[model samples]
Target: MGKATGFLEFDRLSEQNIPPHERVKNYKEFVLHLTDEEAKVQGARCMDCGIPFCNNGCPVNNIIPDWNDLVYRQNWEEAIKVLHSTNNFPEFTGRICPAPCEAACTLNINSDAVGIKSIEHAIIDKAWELGLVKPQVADKKTGKKIAIVGSGPAGLAAAQQLARAGHDVDLMEKNDRIGGLLRYGIPDFKMEKSHIDRRMEQMAAEGVNFLTNHNVGENIHPDDLIKDYDAVILSGGAEWPRDLPVPGRELDGVHFAMDFLPSQNKVVAGDKLSEQILATDKHVVVIGGGDTGSDCVGTSNRHGAKSVTQFELMPQPPEKENKSMVWPYWPLKLRTSSSHEEGCDRDWSVATKELIGDNGVVKELVASRVEWKDGKMAEIPNSEFRIKADLVLLAMGFVSPQQSILEKFGVDKDARGNVKADTEGKKAYFTSRDKVFAAGDMRRGQSLVVWAIREGRQCAHAVDEYLMGSTSLPR
Candidate 1:
């Protein structure tokens, strides 16, 4: 341990964020990272417990304590090595991930947890500045070709691993550009696209081919991939968004969050729109309270929305978790994101009855207060109200993987409509179709970027085993 009593002597410190007013003026990263000495102190807060639950809490199973000590001792080069061992992109996770590892920290029992995420952020940013990260090209050629369907974190992870293992890897994306959600779904303000671009450059150097504007099931045939590649990995994400079937759902301004988010991202990337879907000078109501909803709020603010409000069907969680009961596990608590602080009216236990509009353009939302009785929600009879809303975004989350592509492969799906694949036991990650494997959101449904990376890494190992009989890649 860096210091035996570091945990007792030090308190936790989080990274600062740019003022909401200043940040909303443009699309750029707002979080100000910790200075080197501050980061060291935060790293010192890690107890380096004998059994680090933080490791277990991390979906990528990052060696948390080891890296914490490395950073605390200012062994930055080694810290980056340890961070990269499990996670392919710490910069992505550092900004977007909720940091379940901090919640699961041994020190969080009665005090603030170690600032693991910030430490990771500092290490990676420093590594890049020092030109420490580079492509690791394969020394020998396996001559076997592999096709990865999707260019998100999962597909990128699998493609990089397989390519380094001497397989010719092709990462395919249906979109006009690569990075899938990373390139489009996420706003540049949260994490700039340059991070993805730099990694893509490195992957290219490692001999991974990226084919954008290539829709596998539509443009390219499934049979063609089967005939050409030795094996195929389906990392296409769960994209079928959940919808509200309320009255007036067909209104012009009522749209899914995905429908709205991507356009703004494109605009930020310098794409001029003929008819932009904007929330500017309008009352915006974002349904569902989660990361996607928060993102909508932030984007709407950037668009100079007249007003923004978010709705959550469930009641607000406790401000502080009962640590004795929830320690070492992610707790249910109120999470006020940076977007929320940027000026948003948040309402809980609310349900939208319908979109009230005139001439097919949304004017307001008819909503009602709701109460859960016996685990089922019911609208209160006298609590109905109308709220002005020119733009209504349904950020209620995704339902399943798009059926068209999954149907094209004829892969079996579970009751939840996710690809049927065991994450454990002998046939892990293998789909019902031979030589076809699935991972990430396609298999596990909508999830965090960290979980996607983990599944991608593990699925790569499974695919490697199927190809070589025995594999050296870590699961």
Candidate 2:
């Protein structure tokens, strides 16, 4: 431990943000990182408990205590090393991850947990500033080839690991650019695309080839991958956004959150659009309260929306969790994201009845209060109301992986329509076809970026073992 009573002496501190008015003026990151002294104090808050539940809570199993101590001692180079030992992209996670590790901290029982995420942010930012992060190309060649479908977090992680193991790795993306969601789904204001570009450069230096605009299933055949590579790993994300098939669904202003968010990201990327889907000077209603919904709120604010409202089908969760009961586990509690703080009218226990429009453009949304009975949601008859909404973005979440790619591979699918792979037992990550494996959202359905990284790392080990009968890579 850095100090005997460090946990007792220091309190948790989060990163500061720019004023909402200032941030909404442009598309750029707004979080102001802690200074070195502040970061050290935050790091000192780690108890360094004998059994660190934070490790278990982290999907990537980062050595949280070790890095905390390292940063507390101002040993930033070592801190970065420890951080990178498990997570390949601390910058990405530091910016976007919800930090379940903090919830699972031993200190969280009484005192606040150490500022693990902020410490991580400081370490990575310092590493970048000092030019400490670099590519590590293999010294010896294994001469084995691997093809990874999808260039999202999962595919990138797997590709990097396999490339470092001396295997020839090709990371393929169906999109016009490399990053699947990271490049498009996420707004630049949350995490700029430069982060992805820098990592891509490092991966290229490490001998991992990236092929953009390659729709492996539609344009390139599954047979092509099998013939060219020893193994194929499917890491394509779960797309297929859940939809509302109510009355007036085909209205001009009603759109999917994915369709709405990506276009703004494209515009931020300097793409000029003749007729963009915008919320400017309009009343925007975002359906479904989640990260995507929060993102929509933020984007609409940026577009200068007249007003913004978000709806949650389920009732609102308690502001504070029952820590006694949910200790060391992620609890159900209200989470107000940065987007929510920007400005939003949030409603819970709401169900949309239909989109009300005139001349094929959305004018308002018809909705009603919902009550749960026997685990089923039913709209209350007399609680119906109409809210002005010039644009309606559906942020309900994804249903499954895109069926076209799954169909092309002819892989078995589970009842949820996710790619069928034994993620447990002896045949974990193995698809129905020989020499084919699936991971990330393709197998697990819609999930956090941390979960995707975990699956990617594990899938790499599975693939390595399948090829060489053993693997040094950590699962």
Top candidate when judged by lDDT against the true structure: 1
lDDT of 1 by residue, 1-475 (tens): 8887999998888899889989999999999888889988988888958999999999999999998899889998899999999999999999899999999998888888889999999999989988999999999978889999998999999998898888999999999889988998999999999999999999999999999998999999998998899999999899999999998899999999999999998888888888778999999999999999999999999999999999999988899999999889999999999999999999999999988889988898999999998999988889999999999999999999999899999999999999999999779999999889999999999999999999999999999888988888887
- Looking at candidate 2, what is the lDDT of residue 39? 90
What lDDT score belongs to each candidate, Candidate 1 first? 0.92, 0.92
Against the true structure, what is every candidate's RMSD?
A: 0.9, 1.1
Stretches of model 1 off by over 4 angstroms after superposition: none
- Scored by TM-score, the top model is 1
